[model samples]
Target chain A: MDTWEKLDIGLVMTVLGMGIVFLVLIFLSSLLGFFERLFGTRRSPAAQEPKPAAPAAAEEKPPPLPRPPSKPAPEPAPAAAAPAALRPAVVAAVMAAVSAYLQAEALALEPPVKRLPDDLSFWGRAARLDQMMARRL
Target chain B: MSIGESILRFLETMGFAAMTWQQAVMIGVACILIYLALKKGFEPLLLLPIGFGVLLGNLPLAGLMAPPVYETVIDPRTGQAVQEMKEVGGLIYYLYQGIKLGIYPPLIFLGVGAMTDFGPLIANPRSLLLGAAAQFGIFTTFIGALLLDFLPGISFSPQEAASIGIIGGADGPTAIYLTARLAPHLLGPVAVAAYSYMALVPLIQPPIMKLLTTKKEREVVMEELREVSRTERIVFPIVVTAAVSLILPAAAPLVGMLMLGNLLREAVSMQPILNRLLKTAQNELINIVTILLGVSVGATASGPLFLNPRTLGIILLGVFAFAVGTAGGVLLGKIMYRTSGGKVNPLIGSAGVSAVPMAARVSQTVGQQYNPSNFLLMHAMGPNVAGVIGSAVAAGVLLSMLG
Candidate 1:
C-alpha cells in the first residue's frame, strides 16, 4: 500500500486540530467566568435604589393644583376680561381690589333708601374671603 | 531595413508578441473576477485589485511581478564569488515581500481588532466552543487533500496541505499568512479561495445551517446578554494577549497584534491623539495594505500556475472546509441546545465558521425566517468573534508543526 493509503494523517489532523481548538476556546470561556468571579459585579443604574426617591419630603407633599375663580361679581361685567397671561395670584388680587372699589362706588352712587338692611355683612364677608385667599396663595 | 525585419520589430512591442495561450486565459479569468467584483459584488475591495493585478501580471513583457535576479560579484579579499540579488524588482514583486515575510496579515489583524466589538463574546463566553468547533472544516479538508493525491497534477505535501486547509477558516489574512509561509507558490489560489468563500458566507452557510438545525431549535429565544462591565472589556484583550502568547508563541504575532488593536480601541485612559493615530491604522493603513496585498497575491496567479489541477483541488477543498466547518458548528450548537434544555439556538453554531459579522448576520436572517421576533445577531456574534481567535490558534498550530 502507498504511504498515503497506509497513513490516516487526515483523520489524525482532523481529530487533533479540532480537539486543540476546542480545548483552547473552552479554556478561554472558563477564564471569562474566572475573571467575572475575581472582579465583583458592577451595579447598573436600574439595579440601584431609585436614588432615595428624590428627597423624601418633596415626594410626600405635592404642589397645590390651581383653583377656578369664584362667581364673577355682578356689577355690569367688564367688556374685556383681564389678559390671561397674568399669574393666578395677581389676577385674584386685581379682581378683589376691583370688586371692593366697585362696591364702595355703588354705595356712594345708589339711593340711600334702596340699600338693604345690614349691608355691613357684605364688607365683613369680603374681609373673610380675603383672609381665605391669602392662606391658599 | 528589410520589410520582414521591420514587421518583426514592430510586433515585439505589442502585448500579443510574447503572450501565451495560458496567459490569455488568465486575463479572461481576471476579467471575470473584475466583473464579479463590480457587478456581482463579490468581495469587491480585494477582488477588484486582485483581478487588475492578474491582468497586469499576465501582460507580455509588463515585468510587474518578475522574479529577483542575482548578479555574481568577485570578492577581492576572499577571491570568491559572492552573489548579490537585486533588491528591487517590479511593483507587485516589491509588494509581495510583505506577504512573503508574513508582515501584512498580522497588521491587518490589528485593524480588525480595533474595529471589532467583543461584548457579545464576553457576555456569553460559551460561544468560544462553537468558534472552536467550526474549525473542523480545516482539518477535514487537510485529510481530503491527502486522499485526493491519486489524481494527476494534484499532489500536496503535508505543508501544502496545511496551507489549503486554512482556507476553510474563511479568514483571508490567516490563509495568506499560512500559504505564504508553508507553500508560497500557492498563495494566490489560497487567498482568492479564502476571500471568495468569506464573501459567500451568507449563501454557503444557510443551507448547512438549516439542514443541521430543527425548526424548534431555530426558534429558541435566548436571554438578553448581561451588561458587561467596562473594566471587563478593557481587561479582555490584555488577558487574552498574555495567556495566548505565553501558551502559543507561534500565535503571538497575530494574536498579540489583534489584542493590541482591541486594547488601543477600548482603553479609556488612552490619549485622544494616540487613539486617533491608532484609528488611522484601523482605517487608512488597513485599506492601503489590503490593496497592496490583494494585487500582489493576484499577480502570483499567472497562467501555468493557476490553471493547474492542484489549484482546482485547493478550491474544491476550500469549499469542503467551509461546509464541514458550518456543519461542525451546527452540530456543537445542537449539543449545547439539548444540554441547555433548548435555550441555545443551533443557528448560531454556523457563525462559528468565523466570517465575522456576515456569518452572524446569516444566523440572524435564518432565525428570523422561522421566528421574526428572535434576535440572534448579538448572541451569534459571541461565537463569530470567537471563530477569529480559534482560527488564529489553529494557524499557529499548523505553522508550528509544518513550518
Candidate 2:
C-alpha cells in the first residue's frame, strides 16, 4: 500500500490495538480477583469469632483464684497432668524410642521441658538466605 | 621480475585496491561501534561482537557472506541427481539463518522468561493497563513512519513501518521477532535501533518521566504489595498463555516460549536436574545465543544497506517511539494517581515501556532523586513485566492485521 493508505491503516490499528490491550487486562484483573476470593485461605470473620470464645470458656473453670507462686505452679501441672491422663510409661516409652532412633543415651533422651516458640520471622529470614545463596551460586 | 612489475602486481591484489568507498565507510562505522562498546560501555556484550562482525563482513574479497551457488550432484542415499547448494559463505552467514528463519527471538524469549518474575504483576494486576498504555508508541510511530514517505528516499511500506514501530516496545526480542517476520531486509537497522534504545533506557526514559511527573507525584510512596501465593504465581503463565493463544494464535511462538520458560523457573519443586537445566538456559544458553544473534545481525548491515536515509530514519523514529511510549505510560499513571487518591507513584509509569529491569531501575532512580526513602523498584516491576506481554500482544495484533 501507498504511504497515505498505510498511515490510515496504522491509525486504525493504534486505537484498536490499545483498546483491546486495556480490555483484556481489565478482564484478567477481574478474573484473577475472583479466583483469589474463591480459593482464599482466610476464614470469614463471623466463622472465626465463635471459635476463640469456646476455648476461653473451657479454660475459665481452673482460674477461680490467682496467687503469684500458685500461677507458676499451675502452669507445670497441665504438662504433668497431660502425661498422667495417658497410659502409664507410654510417654517415656515414646521418648525412649525417639532416643533410640537418634542413637543417644537413655538419660540424654529426656525431652527438654522448655518449649521454644517456632518463630515465623526466623523461617522467613532463613528462606531469604537460601534464595540469596542460590542466586549467588 | 622488475621492481615496478612486482609493485604493480602487489597493489592489484591488495584488499585496499578491492575495497569500495561504501565498504570503507562501513568499516569506519564498525570502528565507532567498537569504540562505543569499549569506551562508553554501551551494551558491550552484544555491541562488541556486532562491531567485529560488521568489520569482518565489510572486508572485500573475503567471501565471508558470499551467496552460495548450487550444483547438480548424484546423491548416494537417494540414488538420484539432485541440485545441492554447497556451503560457500562463512560462519556468520550460516548463523544469520537462525535470525532469518525466526528462530533466535523465540529462543531468546525463553531465556528472558526464565530470568523474569511475574510476582509483581500478579500482586498488582492493574499495572497491566499501564503496560498496555505504554504501547502507544508502537502505533504512534507506525503512523509517523508511514508519513515519513513525504521526505526524500524515506518511504516505508506497511510492513517496514510495522517493523520500525515495534522499536517503541523497548524490548529486543519482540522487536527482532516482528522485524524478522515482516521486513527481513530491514533487520539490521531495526534490531540495532531496538537494542541501542534499550541500552539507553536509563538516559532516555528519565527526562520524559520527569517532564510528565511532578516532584510530589514522584515522591508518592505506594502501599506495600500483598504477597502473591505460589499457586497464583504458577497459574499466571498458564492462564496468560491459554488466553493469548486463543485470541491471537500468531503470537503463540513468542508468547508460548516465554510462558514455558516461566513455568520452568516456577517449577522449582519439579526436580533438581530440571532446576539446573532451567538455570543453564537462563545463563549459559542465553549468553551463547546472544553472541551468535548479535554477530549475525551485524553482518547484514553491509555498506549499501545500512548507510541509507531509511536506516537513519528508523533510528530517529526508534528514539521517538520510546519517548512517546514513556509519555503515554506516565500520563496513565497520572490518571491512576488522581483516581486512587494519590496512592500511586507516577514515576513507575515510565517502567511501562518494558526494557525489563533496566526501565524499572530507571523508575526507582528517578523516584529516589525526588525522595530517597521512597522505593519504587518492586512497584515499577509490575508495569515492567506487563510491558513485555503488552508488546508481544501488540506484535501479534500487527502480524494478524498486516502479515
Pairs in steric clash, model 2: none
> Compared with the true structure, what per-residue lDDT tens digits does model 2 show for residues A14-96?
88878877776777677667656654334223222333243244456666566245321212222112321333345566667
Candidate 1 C-alpha error for residue B107, in Å: 0.8
TM-scores of chain A across candidates? 0.30, 0.30
List RMSD in Å for every model shown: 20.1, 12.5
Residue B312 lDDT in candidate 1: 92
Which number leads on DockQ? 1
lDDT by residue (tens digit), candidate 1, B211-294: 888889999988767777777888899999888877778888888888888887777355566678577868998899898888
Give one digit per residue, the lDDT tens place, for model 2 in B37-122: 89988778778878887888899877777777789999999899998987576777789888888888888889999989988888
Fnat, model 1, is: 0.54
Ten-residue stretch with the least lDDT total in model 2 chain A? A72-81
Q: What is the Cα-based TM-score of model 1?
A: 0.80
